[model samples]
Target: MGYSRGIGIVGLGVISRAYLETLVGHADVRIVAVADLDAERARAVAETVPGARALSVSELLADPEVDTVLNLTIPAAHAEIAHGAISHGKNVYGEKPLTAVLDDARAVMASAAAAWVHVGCAPDTVLGTGVQTARAAIDAGHIGRPIAATAAFFSAGHESWHPNPHFYYLPGGGPLFDMGPYYLSALVHMLGPIVTVQGAGSRTRSVRTIGSGPREGETLDVEVATHVTGVLTHASGALSTVTFSFDAHASEAKPIEVHGEAGSLSVPDPNYFDGDVRISRGDGWELVPVSAGYEHGSRGVGLLDFAVGDAPARRASGELALHTLEVMTLLLESAETGERRRVSTAPERPEPVPLTTEAEWRRIADA
Candidate 1:
């Protein structure tokens, strides 16, 4: 069978498994190569994939057969991997936040533009039925003019579950940067671009102990705020109150809620592909039928969307990722300075994903 695109993945971490599960043996794209800092790990992963070989990162980037670089590296390595791919004349798709810092994300965008290669980023969860249905409702005016929104995500932290959870406490690993993309990206899709933001945050603890790994009972220093809250002013004059916390134990807050002149919407968790989207219109809340987005979507769906789509038409384009990154970074910065910050990059809300089944998208991609 002929493959339309070739993917060379760099990074064999936990998240890479999810992408591989979603992409391997697919019809439209092929796993041509795999690379990681750990040569043995790369080879092990490659053995599980057909038509794929383990190569050094540099070799994989320069390989003629690779059309796109799947960067699953840590947040700090996002820009570096993207830059390498762009320099080698390949498209790039990666895990979220674009980069550890906003400036690096900007550089990546500039580099990709100059190279004329498309860039895509993750948290494509918004393209799923959960968030997309809510977006469709808003766009169709099922909820009148959107006026306000509230989004919250709180957790005790990842140390309890993840083996190597040190990054969760680092500069780019805080809850806001690490998980804000899901909620923020969903909000951006549901509402519009954000113009300004005001934020406040706190660091609940200076150190965290690893809970269940070989390194269990070990402790790591915390370098970022553990709890963060902010207000975003969307370009459409809508306000969204957001709270992201690694310090909180638990909360019953909806993942996202948007209020409009006519009604209200309770959006499901943006981290996953599908969930019930409830709407409240004068009466009580009712489940809005899944009206849009890809059905049974998963991690690499964004990459598949990127491959079969032109840059302008891609739902998970790099511009949206960069804007989301800026919003997150500025919000954290605002927390430190006790001031309101204006978001500079205003990418238009990505084109909405219509109700599409797995077979439909795959057929489109295969074509």
Candidate 2:
């Protein structure tokens, strides 16, 4: 597919800044337009990108110059924005979880298919060096057959730092939904799609107080589970014990660990793209040095690279987004029903695009 000069970006929120910084300097992408509910916010962000105009969501969708619409809105609005973009004949790149509701996600997928517009999601972080190196090692049988795995994401709460943390406790914003994509994406990349899930969940407290930021000491109501634990049965018959906790105290541990018959691999925090991939053998865990050619601030650049044909479309595809949504939906289902939820979706394996040299890395990095 031929690359467009630039893509239009919607939602000029805090998360969109990282993407803007990366796009401004890239030769492959141009920031054509920016839209937000807050017109002032959209105008402010538009000032930074050359030839970019501020528009309402409707206006941006109507703009003939926009080939792809990058949806960076909150979880609640993801489905609406993606559907609108697809309906207007523009490809979509949305933030994680795809949508808060399973039906909405399926609807968005169906819309993208009928429109023949490419639909993809974020947390393409797994495509970075950290997770990719681990995947390569596992695929080479360096870890032998996988046996079991464990992953955890624990935090005090988002009320402390996020400007609007009320939504963090909402349906799609809890620890599991908020941070689960990062961990789960890495897990699936290494272990394949999960087949079944059995779990338990609870809300430790109904109300939480903000610890910092302007809302410090302010109280907020929590509607979703603050603590959750589950067992995931992978297609390979490997079982993974996963836990997500928003009520817990601080802890110092990598969020994911995969155990195989021969050895184990420790993945760095998936929230960010680049980190070390450690391996365990006769000696204790040894850090496997792998360099992610891309810089840290370019969070969404990898996906943009894939989209523009500057690099191979190794990640950030719609199938992966659907699989991630499936895993998350079933986790919640199992917790609510107190029974093992069987997943009907299967994993789709894309041919591996080799990144064996510095030049290969440069092709993606420099682009």
Candidate 3:
């Protein structure tokens, strides 16, 4: 593929900054335009990039120069934004959980397919060193046959820091939907797809107060779960205990671990790329030194790979989006139905990509 000049970004929220910073110095990519419901936010982002214009969502989608639409809208707007982009013949790059609803996610996937445009989802953090390294070790049989795994995501609560914390408590924005993608994506990467799931979840508190930020001391009406715990049975016969929580207080550690018959692999926190990875061999776990690489904002890396023609078409395809949505939906379904939920669909695992190349690894590690 030829190099893409850049992609247009929609929704200039907190995450867009990271993508911009990462794209600025890269030869393969650029941000050619920006759009947000908030015009000021779009203009602010446009100011940072050369010749980049701030446009409305319609204008961004219609522009001939915009090859892909980066959909960073909130959870509620994800599917609609993606639908609009696909309708206008632009590929889409979306934030995690794909869409708030499973059926809508399927519709978006179908639309993208008919349009022949790609749709990629975020938490492409899985492509980073942390996940890649673990995948490589597992493929090399370093951990032996996978048997069981555990993943935990915990936060005091988002009300503490998010300027607008109300959305977080809504149906599409709880701990399971918000933070579950990173953990689920990592688990799928390491253990393959889950065939069955059983879960129990609840909101520990009826209302939460922001710990800090402008919203501090404000009360938020809780609509969805604050805590969730589930068991995932993978196609490979690995069973994983997964937990997501907004109510817990605990010391920070990596969010996931995959145990094999022989040993265990501890994954780095999935929120960022290039954290420490360790393998338990014999008596103790040994920290694996990360390879180096340029640390660009997370959103831009996949687009950068696309711009450089280094990745496949639909490289961040909608199918992965569907799979993630299915997993999350099942988790919630299991919690509500009081029965084990089976995930019929699973994300395809590409062949293991090694992290042995010093220069490439350094580029990712350093980044």
Candidate 4:
């Protein structure tokens, strides 16, 4: 294994900042290059990191020094960028949903398989202390024989703050697709894989008006459902209720709650790295100490996981993303068809990440 993994990043967008913030000074990986449609944007971002160079997308993919590609592009471009990296003989770690479309995701997976490279995607938040601790509790029998789970994420439209809120309303972008990965990924971590799903969805308005940025008054057409509710049947015979929405302004429900035979666990937001995992065993809610998962983890921990291993790290594998994508997209399908849909794809439950203090992980990385 190499002392430092060479990484080239593509799509220097808003989310890219979070990854850079996490990976820039980390010892496990080296940011060799960066690229974006706006060359100036990539250059600006690269300048902040020592030894990182700004390159064109194609050049970055082809750079022999780049062992992996960190793809931070929009949903539509995910597969294309990932395929490009794989074709160039580099592993790829990308943002969520895998691809905007299922067929495209399949193609990307097949391509990586053929090339014998690795593909990983986001919502690695599942590897963080919050979800990991929850998983640990379940595995340790703290929550005996999990029965049901609830994943709720309700919030106002992103147009209220996002400068480029237009994408959230597009076909691949919706309340479900935009935020469902986090919820679903956490559920899978706590329970098991989903086997079937039935759902109902609705759209609030035909258009949304931006409330911030220079384009504050601009309107974007709503091309996808705003509210989605579903029931997921897990392979373990457990059922998980999912509620994701961008049509509402507030929600009093916990982000996620998993109920088992012995007790119920309140999991923190899957979009975040760490938070308290509370459990209730009839007496009252009590905090479960952070017993497992990465401490002080952040956005790029998945990429960092990818970097430390020879193969695509299971903690953030593409198969996990594929399962998550299938679960979410099927919810939309079931909503449209007004019938329950069986999920044909079943990704293996990613191995649990043991409690590893960030400092220890770094020490091992630096060794």
Candidate 5:
């Protein structure tokens, strides 16, 4: 049997606010406790959640009332936190990238299997209306046999905005690692699993200055490529060109586009739950109405599917996140080696989300 809907959160950072807001009031799930490296932060957040306590990380993981651990830790700590959760017989739902390294993530998957616990990860935004509608269109043959695509994620760097942006420049932290999950996860769903990848990367500066939060003007060394461009060959024979960049000032490109023999599709930002998904015939790009997925969805919506929903599959399963991670890691490998790299993981595209209204799915998207 699957774990209960009781939840314990680990790592109370910036992203924790969104998860807390989304999960706190849900009926099917209970927020049993929250733990963070910072005890004060955990205590403060727990104070706001009725019946939720601030516990040490170990205590929260071992709490029998908690069936799942919502891991909101940094990339480096993802694997460790998740392993801890599974060790205590808890399911785990986490923020994106899965882990900072590929091998560590693999071990997490292995551990989950051995422990018989479920693992789910984020960018559940893909399960939202925009991407799902677009996906439904593709599956419905609105874009006949998707042949190609372009996914672009461009940013000037999060250093200026994120409180502690140092991680964004590290080996596992660039635009591809930070923002690529949404694009890659959406692409995998729309185009199927990526089999081969070739990429090239570059960095514009060695150090970046912090732009916002408490530590403005602080400079951190940049260790990873700031700009990454790649070509992914999906198992279905579709090819996708991707450009993920922190060096870019801006872009005119749509977030993602899919071209098929019959027509083309413009997908909304995969990072967000809702937007306008447009399709283009010979005439021009036309808005595709919300045809599928949870209406008015938000963060942690994917975790809801994991908690209480019974479907053919968990749409936001950790396996998919692992595949997304493997793809990104291989993209970097390909870039560094100047050789086409074959991805080792091949996660199935999640089942499509049925069209449901905000009034309906919202009640449980938080579950």
Candidate 6:
């Protein structure tokens, strides 16, 4: 099949499978190359993708036909891969947090700008119907004025099931850094940008035992907080109380809730693509219909959106990711210093995603 764009993926980790499933045979983008530190793994994956070749990371970055690099590297390697891709004059789309540190993320944005290449980041879950529907309701003033919100994501930790969960205990792997992107990105999409953050955190233990995987029974040192709680002050003056915990066994808290003058909105888990958004007025709760976003969206939809969308229309742009990173890192700093941290960046709210069905987006992709 003819394709409009070429995607060279760097990193064949666990997350790569999701992107592979989404982009491998898609009509709009071709998987031109696959690369990983484990050359065997890369070649194995490449063999499964029609017309795709396995190459070294450097080779993939310099490939003439590779228009964009799909970076699925670890957090620490995000900046390196992005810089390499930008230096090679290719657009890039990567998994969340943008980078392990805020300054690195800023550097990435600056580099991409100087190179005139587009950089898109994930937690594009916000571009899906679950979050977008809630965003639409707010934009339409169905909730009057958004005043406050609550975002909660609790889990025991990734070591329970993930084959390799050591990273979850590292600097960029805490609940907030690993999972905050989903909730925070969705919040920014719905409530606009954040201006300040106050945070507090706790660590339940210094070590975690691997419950599954080949490393089962092995212990991993915890280098960051396992439970993080914070209050984000948005540019719109709306406050959101958030609690992200890897220490918790479970919780019944809704993934997100926005309380406004007219009513309260129950947003679904921002990690997934779609869910029912409910609203509660004085008359009681009612289901808000799915009024926006790509129906049946997947992992690579953001990259596809980046490839097909005009610059101003890219909802998952690097600017948004950088701003999101600043918020998260600043929140961590605030937790350590016991002082509110002011956000340094203010990216404009992205253009809203209109209600687009699966068939519609598929047709658009094919074009």
TM-score of 6: 0.97
TM-score of each: 0.97, 0.92, 0.91, 0.97, 0.97, 0.97
lDDT of 3 by residue, 37-144 (tens): 999988887888877999998899888888888888888899999999899888888887789889999999889889988778877676677877787778779889
lDDT of 5 by residue, 76-131 (tens): 89999999999988899999889999999999999999999889999899998989
What's the lDDT of the predicted structure labeled candidate 6?
A: 0.91
Candidate 6 lDDT over residue span 210-285, tens digit each:
9987989999999999999999999999999999999888699999999999889999999999999999887888
The local distance difference test score of model 5 is 0.89
Off by over 4 Å in 5: 1-4, 364-367
Q: Model 1: runs farther than 4 Å from truth?
A: 1-3, 362-367
Local distance difference test, each candidate:
0.91, 0.79, 0.77, 0.88, 0.89, 0.91
Ten-residue region with minimum lDDT total, candidate 1 = 358-367
Tens digits of per-residue lDDT, candidate 1, 28-89, equal 78899999999999999999998899999999999999999999999989999999999999
Clashing pairs counted in every model: 0, 0, 16, 0, 2, 0
The stretch of ten residues in a row with the least summed lDDT in candidate 4 is: 358-367
Task: Write down the lDDT that model 3 would get.
Answer: 0.77
Q: Supply the TM-score for candidate 4.
A: 0.97
- Give the RMSD in angstroms, all C-alphas superposed, for model 3: 3.1
Q: Tell me which residue pairs clash in candidate 5.
A: 160-211, 160-212
| Local accuracy of candidate 4 as per-residue lDDT tens digits, 1-367 | 4477899999988998888878776777889999999999988998998889999999999999999999988898888999899999899999988999988998899999999988888887889999999999999999799999998999888999999988888877898888898889888888889999999999989989999999999999999999999999999999999998998888899999999999999999999889999999999999999988889888888777777854534678888888888888889999999999999888888888888798865543332
